[model samples]
Target: MSSAAIFVNIFALSCLVISLIKDRAKTKQSLLVAVKSFFRILPIVLIIIIFIGLLLGFVPLDLISKTMGEQAGFGGVILIASVGAILHIPALIAFPLAASLLKGGASVAAVAAFITTLTMIGTVTLPLEIKELGKKMALLRNGVSFIFAIIIALIMGMML
Candidate 1:
């Protein structure tokens, strides 16, 4: 779990225990609600993570490195961003992958674009986002993120 999550859990449990001492009935009801929500969301999140892992497994690292190497230029950046759009990679996996790509001679622009787009935008989870946030908001956010990735790639190319 993330530090934020751990901290929240500790804080919440402390509050719950305090509440239990003050009002057992209300605390029991609140705990039931919290437990129910956790159960409902945990399985979905786990399944998505597993699916992303499987998707990542299908794409060979050598292939990505070769296709997005410095010689590929802006084409490499676009390609990497496209791949990021298709895969819902977690930050933990994405960072190490980026480092590996860098070591394999992938362009800095391509890797930067891939990492930014992978984290900021999520076409793989777009449907769920649209459902939760409305289609327009999801599209706008994703479109902005995609465009920004390209702009960042260009700047990185110029700088590095």
Candidate 2:
């Protein structure tokens, strides 16, 4: 297992033991609630992973790299930033995709733009965000994220 997995296991066990000692009567209920939440979200997480795997399997990374690798000044940056805006993959998928693109010769700018936008800007989650934070806030947040993603991408391209 990964170090993260080991850490999580240790943390969980420690929490369980601590809870049992501190409040034996509440331990079972706490565990049950945790399990319930996990199960509730498991399906959504599984679906996203499956979708990401499929996208990686089908899409040609070589093509992406060739297209986005161009350092055609601002045009390439715009292309990458726009593509990142369109692709709504989650963080888990974005990291792997960015790694693959990097390996396939994609520029640092493209990978950085893709990663930033993938997490900060989301069309799929926009509706929910709009409902929770109001339309104006949601719009402003996405707009700012979009601009900052490009800026970050450009910075990485220059720095790295």
The RMSD of every model to the true structure, in order and in angstroms, is: 6.4, 4.0
lDDT on C-alpha atoms for all candidate structures: 0.81, 0.80
TM-scores of the models, in the given order?
Answer: 0.59, 0.64
Tell me how far the alpha carbon of residue 137 in candidate 2 is from the true structure, in angstroms, after superposition: 1.0
- The local lDDT score (0 to 100) that residue 125 gets in candidate 2 is 87
TM-score of 1: 0.59
lDDT of 1 by residue, 1-160 (tens): 9898899999988998899999999998998998998787676667665755664566675665678877787788898887886777565567757766776668889988988888889877889999999999999999999999889987997799
lDDT of 1 at 74: 77
Backbone clash numbers for all candidates listed? 0, 0
TM-score of 2: 0.64
Candidate 2 local Cα displacement, residue 116, angstroms? 0.3
Error of 1 at 30 (Å): 19
